[model samples]
Target: MASSLTKGSAATGEKTFLGHPSGLAFLFMTEMWERYSFYGMRALLVLYLAANVADGGLGMNDATAVAIYSVYNAMVYLLALPGGWLGDRVWGARKAVAVAGVVIMAGHFLLAVPSTASFFVGLALIAAGSGVLKANISTMVGQLYRDKNDPRRDGGFTIFYMGINLGAFAAPLTIGWVGQELDWHIGFAMAGAGMALGLLFYFIGFRHLNPVSSRVPDPLSAAEKSAVVRKGLVWLCVAAAAYALIGLAGVFTINYALWPLTVLGLVLPAWSLLRIKRDRDLEPVEQSRMSAYVWFFIAAAIFWAIYDQTGSTLSLFAKGHTESMLFGFGFPESWFQSLNPLFVMALAPLFAWLWVALAHRSKEPSTVAKFSFALVMVGLSFGIMMIAQGAAAGGKVTPMWLVSVYFIQTVGELCLSPVGLSMTTKLAPKKYGSQMMGVFFLAVTAGDSTIALLQLCGVPTDTQSWFASQGALAALAGIAVYLYRKKVKLLMRGIH
Candidate 1:
């Protein structure tokens, strides 16, 4: 650990970029373009699937398209477990990120080809590639800052996060317009080009990166590697056999295909918690911290389940139930997807300043309290949507209603998302730090999988009922968390 710390510190004295390390700038740009490709594709996916075949779409039903969307998103999260392990143990973060970029670009290109087979194939590739890239890239950012106590760490991360939002904010307006009004395949091609540009920048800036990213932090012994390979082959064979059986039974629908992933979503967190609990090497304090994180995990899952609907259910609502014309010019439904990230970019600085101001005055809310507030805010957004349903003009509400929903949800995201990341890092046992991060992402997987299953069960067919139920549940969950805050704080063992 000390040696790792020493390696991290090596880059500290190097020249700064925008008052931070230069490597961060490279990472920031790389992640920005990657997110551009990702959110661009995301903004189009459901709309493309549900649109009529005559309109250059697959003509899938809303339920099917949404289920596929959920499963794809869920897989992207689930595969991060192996993805991060591969980076740490086999390929190193640098090589893993590079390979992921290539794979993701290929996925986007495949989507640009305009065949049903290519559509599923493209989505599979994107999910797999994003899994490999997402966790490891962030890990590389941490490697750039050697001092754990560096006051600049939080601000650096804020800057990096803004890059993510920048990409997200731009992709929807550009790619969304192209896909909705021009050509769907052309939009996918643009996404591929965006990733290609990101890769080009990565190659150009590779030399400036910290050396730690270029080598595996933990390499397995040759014997252990051999054993892992043998086990992997066994699992592969088992999966193949199961897939064959499912195909033979003629039950290979989107919902059925996602059943195994949904099961894994439920099982993975349990397995992670059990492993943490049974680890004899962990100190009692470490065990207690892990226990506290469990509550956070659950809360975060609920929050994301509501927040992530912006790309799926909300996108659909904007398309069908919202009036898109402003000043007699109709805009693309996908354009509405940009609202959250745009709001995020605009509001994040104010929220950061507010937190610091409150802290200075010794009046800041506890982390758990902030999470509760996030839930309530998200619930209120849904409640507003429920009201909007009744207030629709000629079966279509104004786009501002959904825009307002995104704005409120962005506030909730500001409270929960960064705080959750900070809490995970603080509460994680040193030995299991990376795995704990993987578990945190599983919270997202849980939420995506849960919502997907609900959609499959026709829960979202009645938008009014769906919004009302989600709003009520989220609000109630917030109150429950607030009530239980004292117990959670005790379990936190002094971690604020």
Candidate 2:
């Protein structure tokens, strides 16, 4: 990996790190460990919730557990809005990400304390922290590559993504297993350790982070300075109001209060962009693509809602109805969570090659085709679930069934997600590139939260009926993608 970094750097005249900056490696490692902690926590969450109180778990009912899971997952991506705002208009990306990492570290430490109060507090802090790190880190990655048309851009993201999966692939099998088989706090402590490693790397390589966008003030022209102050005050007021309301409406569910704010959060940006288009100098294509990017965010959110359920409903599915033994080798349930990232690591290179190969032949499918494929694969994963249900109707369901489902989902992810990253970079106006990426991730927020909500509504773990209902939604999403495939394709006409 270091060799690849050096080789890319050499190729790029040694100005950038492995064609980005040496600093990129620091960010990569930081993100890798952060994901390790996050995915590790995720792998154990459902099992931890469903575990009996006698087994040192909370013994929460599936519905309530799933709801919390959904909200937490949703907030992970949703917090990016304010995170990016802080990075762009307040502190800058690097500082925001660093601070966010610290916050996440604190969250993990809270989980290690082993109290119900600490658990909720820890989750809230981690969610807020992810909002900061998740968006800004990617922005820094883009900053490392000064050349917009650099051939290494896609490869760089691929490399960065691999780092993510490295942590993801290991976390579940290790931290999750230890947590489940022994103590839950041990897993959380492991997560906290991972964050510490990430923070260490960030500080160690801080000097290499030149050209990084900071949240600190730049030497601005008169208009730019005024704009910054105005936006800052607006965000400050909004945040204060939102916090005040949260405190006042203590009886209301956090999700209920937050969802409305989510809407408000979205509209605020839309209003900003509308004014930009109406009054500020803008390119037509840039404006159009930005609009399309918003729609894509909605679509992406839907996908995540279905996909991220692995941590909530699907984890339970493996534990409950699915027969997880093979030749008397009963697989660890947390091990199942490892499959997605493992497949991603295994197949990403092949897909990257395939995409390039297709492009060379002038036969590459449009971005919409890739997205349609993603929806189809998502439906197919659930279809496998449906089949597993049928196979297990009278007896144990084979572990192969769930494995097949994860494999299929991974393929869908390969087609849709990495490609979506490229698409986001292509579509957003230059000024809003990082913010748009943040917006693209909002789909994850909606998707993960939606999954959690489904679980809470008694559709995921407690009842086989609820689990089966997911198949119907997956099917509908596939149909919707198919029906609108052409229209979506039209939006991508000039993106590539």
Candidate 3:
């Protein structure tokens, strides 16, 4: 293990994989397998719950299944708050991630045991573990390159993004096929194995990590340290309140709840902005950028609300309505999940090139422009699905319907997701970057939770109706984007 660690470090420092750290490859492959396990399990979730008792699965109603899926997904992102906080405030990124991996590995193992008690227990572990690993790992990648001006940063992120999708692409096919066709336990067990591999690689490559990478310095002044602790506690209270409200409200009522939770989420940051405005501790430009980060968070949440349906409503749509076939061969329904990642791998380099070219010419779109475009592309993807809905209502739509939809959406992701990550790192004040990353992941949490919330609200589980609803929701989201375009652009001013 020590030898492997040394070898990996040497490789990472010496060669840039596609112009960034070879360590990027290490992170990429680790994330890929982790995602494969994650999405692999995800593809099985609804099917498992909704399947008959004789199928070696839990027979749950579609609404309940989706609701559970949403909560689980949301928790994964929600944990990022504590995970990132711990990295910034206590353990640092490397230790936090290692601990998270172990917890997840244990969680996956619990699931493989085949009991209702174990099942929920496994999910709880997974959620807690994900909270630790998910947010910090991305920040660590952003840490790798020294130059904020390095043209390779975006491409590196895109490549890392591809690894995530590649895992997603393969997971459903491999794990989904085994679980659905052979034994569900087989797929569940594979997820555990995947995590073990991820942990193995991550630990072996730990030495390659730069000491400066996300190393939170000891708070210089007692006052500063005290402020961080206080702020962190405030966030903890806020997250608890958010979760409490969700539990108290019925699933359908969660949408109404978002307004208040959204307000609550921003309270501290807003207060910080006011302080900045007063010139209490920060400069005017710094204050503006901090305020801009808050707005970016809002826009990001809105985007994820539309994008994250891939795991919930979209997953159901692929299974139920869309035709899944390649020539004479019928592809596993879960395999369709790969389209997003597949397109991501293909287009990431191109998008990376486009951004650099435009930046060089002073023709690059503002961060807000990039964000708006991401929303527009996401809407366009849904628009195509709406067409597929019409076709499927008549009969089976071609599998290409889903593929083509994922293709367009992947373009939107290339615009939105990784750039959103970059935007946070760039726009946020240095003292607050990790925390801001945590906040960014929170948007993902809300968006994912919203997907399940919608499913519980009215999204159909039956074949034809579900596709139609996806189209309608997509249209609504697009309208929301159009209305918010100018507001989004205003936030870009403080961003470089």
Candidate 4:
């Protein structure tokens, strides 16, 4: 919408790749390596933390390790709120992305150093950089289109999402092997190198873009900047005080440390929704659409509660409850982390075509309907996991069980994730673009909160019931979404 090239004519014309803009190709490559860096390090995080110091790990307990991993993962998403603000208001999205890349690359390099201090510092930097990069890069992908109704939109997003899996599919195999089988720092260093290459490709192909992201969506005035700085310091102090209180009370464990962040995971999305709905600039239709989005948002939260796309939990499951042996060779548990992304790489193009083909026949499911179906897929995936867990009580089950589960979730992911990305861009207010993208990611954070709460309270002794209860809840939520799909569509005010 900020295009300098005649309403994004350049975006749809001249250079093209796979029937879309060539800029999509550049973004695709960039995202591939960024995700490569992310998932690569993510695959090894909990394992490294839980490993013995004799093996060059911190040797933390299972609960602490898992809690830290979940909170770290959730924070990476929660920070997207501020990241989006900076992208839209402080700097242009393009500039924000480039700077965030440097931060992310630096973070990975730091992790390569293999020290306790270095590890924490590295995680902080990567989380902040990732939060910034994730929101803006996705926003940039949306900018490559002409308008909300562009038929190329979903397909283009699927391609970009495929880029994510391309990296995810490969990183764990390479980085996970090095981290788990060799040296952890070397694997982290490899992640850094991946990010650096992403930066190189991004800068080399910068001119391919339409420069639509160059214009700030909303620039803060001098008065607003001063106000923001003042407010920021006050909140910073409040945070420090609360953190100190946790230490003073002598409950400064990882479980307690996560309280603020997990609570933020819940509070921020709700606050963002209420604030958006209250915006005076919104037309009646915009208000209606925002209201409609609340259902999608909540449903997505429920879906992610069962999804946990990080694979950390499942990697642990694979380590203990599932076998990684094939013939005479054994593989690391992290190898299972690659399954979801590999399936995405194989399935995305098909799903992309399916949506367009359905659209041509006027038989395409509404976005809400697709979301309903996704919930059911995840519910069913968990049902299988429940059975697998029950089977594990007898002995380690076949790896195919986990494989089947990832395949089902991948189907759910193909239905919801990329479509959700495209849908957010469609529904965003003209002025609040990047921030709205950030709000969409909070679904992941909200899901993290739910899981973290369950984990911290205590592990459930009955693993089957644990899985069954969650699976049934997801099935019920799916039915509820299906029942309300018609009303949700009406509230969309013609978005479909």
Clashes of each: 0, 11, 1, 0
Per-residue C-alpha lDDT of model 4 across residues 245-364, encoded as one tens digit per residue = 988998776655677777877888889889998999998888888888889898888888778833656666787788888676789988888988888778877887999899999999
The candidates, ranked best first by TM-score, are 1, 4, 2, 3
- Residues 267-371 of candidate 3: C-alpha lDDT, one tens digit per residue: 533454454345546655666666666656655666676676676666667767777777889776777766776777778778888988999999997776676
Candidate with the greatest TM-score versus the true structure: 1
Error of 1 at 88 (Å): 0.6
List model 2 lDDT by residue over 1-496, tens digit each: 2344445443335645544657778888988999998999888887887788988888987766667777777777778877877777667788988899999999998998879779878888998998889868877877766778967676777778888999999999889878987889999989989999999998887776755565353445678778978998999999778778877978546456445544544454455446544534557766666666655566566667678777777787777777767898866788899999999988988988898899999999877777767877787777667767666667767788878888988998888787788788788777775566666676676576565545434564544455456666665666776677666656655675
Off by over 4 Å in 4: 1-25, 141-158, 211-217, 241-251, 279-284, 327-329, 425-434
RMSD for each model, in Å, please? 4.0, 4.3, 5.8, 4.3
| For model 1, the run of ten residues with the poorest summed lDDT | 1-10
Writing each residue's lDDT as its tens digit, candidate 1 over 1-496 gives 1132113334445567666766777888899999999999999999999999999999988877777788788889988999999899999999999999999999999999979889888999999999999979988887777877877787778889999999999999999999999999999999999999989988887877878898998899999999999999999999999889989998787665667776777677678778886899999998888778888888888888888888888888888888889878988999998998989888989999999999999999999999999999999999998888777635888888998999999999999988898899899999987788888888888888888888767776445788899888888888888999999999899999
> Is 1 or 3 the stronger prediction by TM-score?
1
Off by over 4 Å in 3: 1-25, 142-159, 211-216, 219-295, 360-362, 455-496
Least accurate stretch of 10 residues (summed lDDT) in model 4? Answer: 1-10
TM-score of every model? 0.94, 0.84, 0.78, 0.88
Question: Could you tell me the lDDT of residue 116 within candidate 3?
Answer: 77
List clashing residue pairs in candidate 1. none
Off by over 4 Å in 2: 1-20, 146-151, 211-295, 429-431, 455-469, 491-493
